[model samples]
Target chain A: MTHSDQISDSDQMPRSAWLCEYLARLEDEQVMAQHGDARILAPAHRLELDPEGWATAAKVAAAMGLRHAGLWADCLDDSALAAEDRAIRMQACLEHAGDYLVLETQVPMLRPVLASQASIYPGVDRLERHAHDLTGLELTSQPDGRRWTRHQAWPEDRFPLRGDFPLAGEPVGRAPADADYPFGRVQGTGVYEIPVGPVHAGIIEPGHFRFHAMGEDVLQLEERLGYVHKGIEKLAVGRDPAGLARLAGRVSGDSTVAHAWAACQAMERATDCIVPARAQALRGLMAERERVANHLGDIGAVCNDVGFAFAHLQCGRLRERWQRRSQALFGHRLMMDAVIPGGVAVDLCDKVVEELREDHAQLKSEIVPIFDVVADHPSLDDRLMTTGVLSEADARQLGCTGYVGKASGLAFDVRRDSPYAPYDGLAMDGAILAEGDVAARVRVRMAEIGNALRWMDRLLKSLPDGPICAQLPEAEAGAMGLGIIEGWRGEILSFIRFGPDGRIARYFPRDPSWFTWPALERLIHGNIVPDFPVCNKSVNGSYSGQDL
Target chain B: MFRILKKSFQTGVVTETPPDVADAEFERIGIELRRRIDVRFSRSLAIRQVDAGSCNACELEIQALNNAYHDVARFGVHFVASPRHADALLVTGPVSRHMEAALRRTWRATPSPKFVIAAGDCACTGGEFGASYASCGAVEKVIPVDAKIPGCPPSPLELLQGLLHVLRG
Candidate 1:
């Protein structure tokens, strides 16, 4: 179908119905469809597909303009199935609008192989490699089969996510340098490479960037991350719901609130726990605060990159004040551990609510004028405008989300598109622009900060008076839950499965950085090498979030 | 331009005075740190931060030290881009296996008479993600550490105090 044809159909029908009709047209008999649990706020349609159907579904989904949301694999340790059927279950999440469909296929433990989806959705490249690295799965017809989460840490034969493989793998005395990892070569006279950090000059997370450049202009930029991989999945294998929430909060410390909420949402849904209305509102409030704080810091950092020290300091000061308020009200600066399995850990009394209101007003007054100055600054505009532009077509293909995608005209906000409790009937605005440059990204952040402040005001006014938490009931073994949250950076998808003894069987929190990180590589094609920092800051993919 | 200047003028010098050394142990360390700074390396202390394998929370707090509130530069402590120019290395996270070599290289690159201060519980004692096949628990496991600032992530004030304590020795 043509783009126009599909758009018309998509506009006429609801997203779920349109998607269901499209999937039906694929005519794959092996595709088994089932409706997800009604308890889930954004319920996903589960699809059990054969190996052939798995590869075809991804290709068909791409053709139908479905965004590749997430891809993860879980090792099944059940001995009840025959040896031929004893397998690893691989799941691919495809999303369009607010609707979600999970495509699952089981690959046998002996010679686990599947067709690669990277050719269709470029964002799935690293995730497929990650699944392969951790679960010993092989991808046939793959493009760029380089090892991604395995950098001389584990031998070729060993896979950390296997049930038999111990959490604490055989510790080596010293790890060797990953110098031999092949980087794609751009052949030309004076086409040199600038290799930047696993340890950057600035105080940030570790990830290496290889820039193929000639003179000042960059030819290509490739990112080699996963330096912060701490066996998050392996460590999460047997954690209780509370323990899992703590682990999730740390997935990306900056995004602590969002990650924790997503994990908790997943677990809460799996166990059919009904979170109290007050707790839901508080969670929304905390998430908005988190978004504002990060945006303030980022807007300033982007300015700092272009040598705008005044904006940087002002933004930083405001962000520090914002986080200090969070610490006072929510108990943690990042609001980590505030969102538990069923509900929130802290509640706002009248006095605390008043304090929050006063702080919000103070922040709004201070930041508005600063943003005005930033938006109108001539020198800032000269550097940021039309620099490192990510085309909308490229963005759609890469499945970019949050400000990065919205700035580029691919407006897909999880909060607005898939409204959960607290946001269902809330008055909110999404900031979208088609400029797709550093300035656009910064503008998106500024707009988001304003919206969050307004939302917080509304939530504080309508603050419900009730219990802050609900007890999570026990879920039967093999029960799965999915949580999709709109974090500051972008969409955060968390998948959770409960074990027989009420412990976590499998947990995978896919950060939006998994998709946006590739967009950075695409956007930085012809930009000058020095502009890389500003461009990178604009996209600012979470190293720890994706690395986990 | 006028608005920017006017705003700057209105927000003049928002930096606050450092918190008074109330605790006896901290006061002792503060005095010792002052003496060391005067005698060994002038007043300025340059630190190179290495994210060994942190959740990035510690890094955020570390960055906060430079803001207008803390303004750690005024305290004669500032972050440097290179380890060679650093008097100490401020490291965070439970050293992941992939970063082991990089961390060691960084430590070796620092000049003699340099200290390594482990920031956050992960760096101090591996926090929640303890030693696994992928991680080498704690910063000290890979390289010698002089002092440890412990919290899931120590606050900016605690980090400043931790830096002062390490400077004392």
Candidate 2:
């Protein structure tokens, strides 16, 4: 049957309903549909699919306009399954509107291979390769099968995520260089390559960017990341709920609040624990503050790239003050480790609430004028406008989200699209633009800062009265949960499964960078090499977040 | 131009004084650090930062040193683009195995008499993501560290103090 024949009535039904109906039509006897844990904020549906159903599901989801959210896998202990059964379970998360559908398929240990979904969702290419490198899962019919996240740290035969692999695997005195990894070559005399990083010139995370350019115009920009992969998933094994929360916070330092919240949310959901209303509101408050701080820093960095030191300096000052307030209120500069499982670690009192209101108002007054200056400046506009354009079609195909996607006209904000606690019943405007350029991304960030400030004000005014944290119950072995949060960058999808003795079996925190990083490669097609820094600053995909 | 000038004038001098040393030992170390910088390095230091495998939180705090609040450059300290031009290497993270070669290459590229300051708990003690199949543990394991700053991510003020301590040596 043709792809359209399967989803002919998709338009007539709600997207989630149509998606569920489509999956149900797959007609595999092994396939089972069940309601996910109640604490998972989104309307979640889990399905067990055969290998054939797995490949077909991606095609159907793509045809139905469902965005490919994430792809991850975990190795199941051999003893846990029958001798003939598969030893690895792979999950593909697909989203429509705010609804999440998780598709699961098992792979045998000896020949662990599955059909690749990269053809349907181009962003899954890296994730599939990463899974292969870490879990020894191969993909048939894969596009670009280069090893990702493996840089001569371990041998080809070793799969670190496997149950038999020790957490502190055979250590070597020195790791060999990864000089043989093949980079896509651009032929012709005029096309030359600019190799940058793994150690950048600035105070930034490490990732190699190979730019094939003809003089100033960039033909292709390929990034080789995973330089910051510190075995986060391997380290997460056997960690208790609290310890896992701390590990999750470091998934991306800048995104500590969001990543921790996602991990904690997943754990809480898996254990069916309800976070108190007050704690939920506090988490929301910290998340919004994180959004504000990151946007401010990004806007400044973008300006600095184009010689607009005025905006850079001013934004830097404001960001410092903002972070100081966060430290005073939450006890950490970046507010890291503040969002624990079952609720928040810190609580707000009337005094701090009033102080925050004053700080918010002051920040608004101070930042608005600077933004006005940046918005009206001709030099800044000339540099940023029409540079690094990512078309709307490319954005949708890559499943870009957050400011990067919103600027390119893919308007999907998890907070607004799939309303969760604290954001539910709250009216918030999504800042979207169609220019798909550096200027548009900056404008979206400015708009988001304003929206977050307003949201924080409302949250403080209607502060819920309850305990900050709740007691978490032990989760049954093999229980699974998912958390999808709208971080400052974009949508962050976290997956967790409980092991024996209530420890974490598998944990995967998929950052929005997974999608946006590919979007960056597409966005820089014809931009000059000099503009790459500004374009990069505008997108600002978290290297550490993606590396992990 | 007029608006920009007016704004800059209104937001004049947000820079603060050098952070105060709490204990007598640190105060003594601070004085010695100042004297050594004046004597050995001619009162100017260029630091090259290497993020071996950090979560990028340490990088943020390091960048904050140059902001208006800290203005570390005013104290004769600045970040350089190359190791050859640097007098010290400020490293962060647990030194992942993937980054092992790169970190060693960076250290060897720096000239002699260059100090290496391990910034953040990860660089000092490997933090949460300690020695693993994928990580090489503390920075000192791969390179000799002159000083260490311990925080999940050391604050900008703590980073300054760490830099000073290393420079004193």
Candidate 3:
């Protein structure tokens, strides 16, 4: 522990002896920033460390029951240092309670390898792979070494997210047919494989799923995804705060509001900008509406996959109406780009608020009876029950959240636990189930929809009278900030660093899909092949969200 | 199912009347479409949708085409699973490099006389996710687009209009 920080620490110390005792085990450690109950900033303790200290710190943090939140990388170009010393810096963010403990370390360009966090947090398998894929820096024990974000679009030697690489990659013709990418072999008696798609039949995102099954039961399911890798990470560099917020919104179109808000929050934090109370409430409203719309659509789609056309039609109608309402209020149906760096672009007048309340009331009456019919249907009950069951152990290990984790008894909701603004005062009952089945997931979604509807009502009732936005001060060079939000699917984390003249040096929005997608492989292990679609729908991992 | 049926009976037909002259709010829009449609193809149009790396915002609006209000099915336009049965390809997003080939394979799979509708700002001009190391901007860069629907995600009404324009042409 550092002498300077021990005497000058901001948050005082020793609420828990565990944290203090653990830090005493390490050398050259000190708290970076303390943000207890801050409206915007995470109550994070940042530790600047050498390479060896970082790997050991991660292991210790994991043992202390800290959940691995996210990892992000950017090249650190120091003008004073020799060219060789300028290195790729990677930061690992870990969460315990509402606090985020961040570890930072740099690896020189010559042999850019570091110990992986996969041993501690198995969920970091993809994050390390993503760091490796984009920065060309290798992690010593990354669970998988295969290409991730780059796909085969870029050549072996070229790392697209590196500072030297141009935005336009020099392609030597069409990318070599990706047909030869290796798939896991499940060699046993009568174990065969079915490759689904990078291109699906219906209106859906692209991801290639390889299922190795014995008879009809799936023995192994390995998903090869990156078909939607849009070079968003590479594009994020050099953008202004507003531009970066727009890019974040597209990280996952469905979670547009949440992602944008997270990015904006990160930007606002970096610049020390405090948004108006009204703006925070509006953001909450938008995020909850997004959650409701997606749940409505998904509930219907799950039924549609099972051939319950009536439920499908009813849900579709409801979703459309909901989207229309969003458009009328937020100026975009999906609410894309509604959130900016300082505040929201649109403000709701009294008339709009009144209409929204009436619409909310009307929708409750309209959807409840239809949902009841589907809930009682014998055919649906037979299909969804006990199918693709993800156990509590698997859910916790995979770090799944939102409905997927809630269905399987992982009672972690970022909003309730973290208590960010607009949600700080709202009482959350937590819709959780231990069943770990498809039916349980549907029930969780239904419960969440009701909760979100009420949350909106509460937010509107206590809407503060103030300016919708605050003018943000100009960004300071090399400032860094982290933003985390409870998105519809789960907790989304955004990391932002500013370059010279306030241009973005790096921005990475870590989607909750990274945790949820891997768990799909586990949940679908013994499920039948035909049931994959419904199982996948129940999980509903976003391809774009993860690939980015 | 019986309860659902009873509710359906109580609600009567939730489906809109013939959109032309049915919704007076869009009389001018209906007249605009009625005037511009080329009417070269048959009345019925079968659509095959290919998501070329969209964030799926466009796909949601496209799916809404099947819902009650903007029922494109009532307009003799429905989404078919197979490209062989399709008359037009409704493509979305700036084609990611990984999806570029699969999109071509889909185009090749469709029978002759197929039209491609680049159905978003991304598909039309690479929108925000521009042509880059991992993305090949615009559906037009890889394949020809007959019609372009431009919006971050074109709304269901806008998509319906685009489809009507294609059917009329």
Flag regions of model 1 displaced more than 4 Å: A1-15, A28-42, A79-82, B17-36
A410-461, model 3: which lDDT tens digit per residue? 8788898866677777766589999999999999998898888887887788
> How does candidate 1 score on lDDT?
0.86
Give Cα distance to truth, residue A268, candidate 2, Å. 0.8
Error of 3 at B168 (Å): 3.6
Model 3 stretches astray by more than 4 angstroms: A1-18, A24-41, A78-81, B17-43
**TM-score for each predicted model, relative to the true structure:** 0.95, 0.94, 0.93
Clashing pairs in 2: none
RMSD of each: 4.5, 4.8, 4.0
Docking band of candidate 1: high
Model 2 chain A poorest 10 in a row by lDDT: A1-10
State the lDDT of candidate 1 residue by residue for A1-548, as single tens digits: 11133235435655477666756856754454444433332376666677866777787787778889979988886556667777888998888778877887888898798899998888899999999999988998779899999987778789999877888886556878788899988989999999999999999999999999999999999999989999999999999999999999999999999999999988876776778889999999999999998898989999999999999999998888888788878888889899998899998889888888888898888887799998989999999999999999999988899999999998899898876677876856889999999999999999999999989998889888899998888877887888888999989999998988899989999999999999999999999999999999999999999888
